[model samples]
Target: MRLVQVAQHADDLERAAAFYSALLGSEPTAVFDPPGLLFFDLGGVRLLLDRNAPTAVHYLYVDDLAAAIERIGDRAEVIGPPHRIFTHEDSTLGPAGHDEWQAFVRDSEGNTVGLVSFRAVA
Candidate 1:
């Protein structure tokens, strides 16, 4: 099955919206007034921001790793900078001779999010 929605706690709607907007580099696709929730479209899935939402660590793929790190700046907490998590030598773990790069950062609400790229481990 495919993921449809991801929920994250957001006690502060405005703050959460702003932080997510900057972090995601896009505004929410849909916002609910009654429930006071915000939805960020992650292609097929949606990031739901509300009080009853569950806390989750989500990873987003980025084409330009350096630019993404630079854009993040000092807003959220950086758990770690870009690094080669898996290299061609670690092919046994996944496919043969494939490298993966990743970095971790915490959102305003303390949910750890990872930025990843499977293209090149640079």
Candidate 2:
């Protein structure tokens, strides 16, 4: 079966929306304010931000880890600087011959978010 949705807690929907929009490079797909719910399309997967949901640590794939971090700028706090995490020798979890890089940041509502990317080894 394929994954559908992932929910994360947000104390302030508007602030969360702004931070995510910038990081995702797109506006939210849908937002319901009365019950406090927000959605973003992650290539068909729903990323739900709710007022009452428990906080979750989610990782997002980026084309360029450094570029993504730069785009985030002061919008979020960079808790972990970008660094290489692994070098794939075979196509098991990631592309073979590429290096996996990751970094961490705190979102607007205080959720830890991980940013990941893969780059070919030089």
Candidate 3:
């Protein structure tokens, strides 16, 4: 299936927009100011931030790890340092692989946003 966009709920639109702007390195492609939904382009994928609702455990993989972190450094609450997650056995469709650098963040509401970088497959 083709994945177009994933919504990450937020409590504050301006706050969330500011955070995402930093993380994405640009303003949202579109923003519904009333509903507080901001849209961002992530490589080929799209990300939608919902200001009224909060989502949890949302995983986002990006090509530029450091740049992503720097963008959201001051806006979102980052958990810890970046580390690789290897041997993800939950999915059998693939073999052993490195999870690459992973970090956590809590938005205005309480949704846990997971940013990750996948190691190149061997």
Candidate 4:
């Protein structure tokens, strides 16, 4: 089956909505008042933000490596900046290989979220 949606908990609906909007480059299109839930359109997927006691780890894969890092707002904690890692190396030919960018960030509840981007190079 295809992956559809992912959710994360939040204590404050407004704060969570703002954080997620800035980080993911999307805004909440709908909200349920009874449960106090906020939904965001994550590309073709959906992200549910529910008002819970605490948050959880949410991992997102993005194509724009540089833009994602820059979009992370001040309130969100940056565990690491976007950096490239060599997966395979051609030792005989020198440093030539595919690279991937990985970085982590912690949300309000200390949930560590990871972002990765893979790029092929010669």
Measured over all alpha carbons after superposition, the RMSD of each candidate to the real structure, in angstroms, is 2.9, 0.7, 3.5, 5.2
1-122: candidate 1 lDDT, tens digit per residue: 88898888887777788788887799989888777788998887988988777788778888766777677677677888888786765556544565777888887777788888765344
Worst 10 residues of 1 by lDDT: 89-98
- TM-score order of candidates, best first? 2, 1, 4, 3
Count of residue pairs whose backbone atoms collide, per candidate: 0, 0, 3, 0
Winner by lDDT: 2
lDDT of 2 by residue, 21-61 (tens): 99999999999998999999999999999999999999999
- Give Cα distance to truth, residue 57, candidate 1, Å: 1.2
Name the runs in model 1 displaced over 4 angstroms.
88-97
* Runs with alpha carbons beyond 4 Å of true place in candidate 4: 53-55, 85-97
Task: Supply the TM-score for candidate 1.
Answer: 0.80
Global CA lDDT of candidate 1, please? 0.78
CA lDDT for candidate 3 = 0.71
- Between candidates 1 and 4, which one is better according to lDDT? 1
- Candidate 3's C-alpha runs over 4 A off are 52-54, 64-67, 87-99, 119-122
TM-score, candidate 2, is: 0.98
- In model 4, which residue pairs have backbone atoms overlapping below 3 Å? none
Ten-residue segment with the worst summed lDDT in candidate 2?
A: 65-74
Collision pairs in model 2: none
lDDT (tens digit, per residue) of candidate 3 on 1-122:
99887877877777777877776667888888785777888876878878655475777766766778776766667775677666455456333454566777775556777887766545
